[model samples]
Target: MINPNLALKVLDSPFHHTVIHNFLDLDQASLSLEALAEQEFIPTESDLFSYSASNNLSISDNPDIKSLYDSLCSKAWIRKLESLFDVSLSGNVDMAAYVYMNGDFLLPHDDELDSRLLAYSLHLTPNMTLSDGGSFDFFSSNTEGEAKEIVKQVVPKFNSIVIFKVTPESWHQVSEILSDVQRFSLTGWYHG
Candidate 1:
């Protein structure tokens, strides 16, 4: 179940972002993790990123995956997000499961895509530490909105959801995974 008194603690140094710990109840989070393991993930690579990812969860047949997606689209959830982020949403959300093993990494880039008002990652990797790598690095941007330097690093925590406003200045990347333990997460964007 969604945490009723979820607090949106905003981070403002490099860019605007927010993280909510224990976003889901224990049972739901465990079930979601199990469902993710059951999905088919394909190795995907580009000049920007290298990771294994399943297709969009919006069309997933798995009941747990569907439930998770449905919960994000629910009016209550949307309203909560809208209130926290201070933005109007169309209730349109896109999500996919990702697994980054050792050597996988994503290059820096701003998520300024069409209609993508906010981006999020629901971390499922338990007991992950800095030594495990796959940390989310946020970069500071120049006056012209170009990525400058990484100003902060957020280590993935279990059952935590990190959301950030998608803008030209929202430059961030997933650092290389240095351990055999895979970094598992549900990541996507909420459209306006």
Candidate 2:
């Protein structure tokens, strides 16, 4: 990790989230991208999302990928997450790399899976801009806890990681990619 001692800002309105910039050093980030690029990605599409994704990174045989996955599952990493989120983590994490090409998108939805306490995305795509159109957008909820309109647009800056607490109101989505550039990132959840 580049910034091992991370300083996080918690936002409570739209949803609880923290964006950590410079999450990994350039060398490590490049290596991670290389490893992930070699892995096969399967086309995945549903009513809510469309993209290509790798299998669970925990099962990867590549040393570089395994090291990264192990680091995330490490005690130090869990401690930092627990401290920052103010929640007890079960030390189990599921991770996979995703590539969203032109026209790819994910609709708004709260990550309320069983035992999922937090969801995260680590951006690895360099030179991605606002014009790229693949941003992590957070949505405000109605009084009934249904997702309404987008309240926050988080550009997926290279080497940045976005973490958010999983709740019924924690609705977010990846805006459609209008550009031809591929939006690549590693995403997953931390179990309670």
Report lDDT per candidate. Answer: 0.89, 0.89
**Candidate 2 to truth, TM:** 0.96
RMSD of 2: 1.1
Per-residue lDDT, model 1, residue 171, is 96
lDDT of 2 at 149: 96
Residue-by-residue lDDT tens digits, candidate 2, 54-98: 998988899888877887888988887798788999988999999
Task: Tell how far residue 127 is off in model 2, in angstroms.
Answer: 0.4
Off by over 4 Å in 2: none
Lowest summed lDDT across 10 adjacent residues in model 1 is found at 1-10
Count clashing pairs, candidate 1. Answer: 0
Report the C-alpha lDDT of model 1 over 1-192, residue by residue, as the tens digit. Answer: 766767767777676789889988888899999999998999999888999999889998898888888887899988877887788999889999999999999999988899999999999999999899999989998888898998888889899988998988999999999999889999999999
TM-score for all models, in order of appearance: 0.96, 0.96
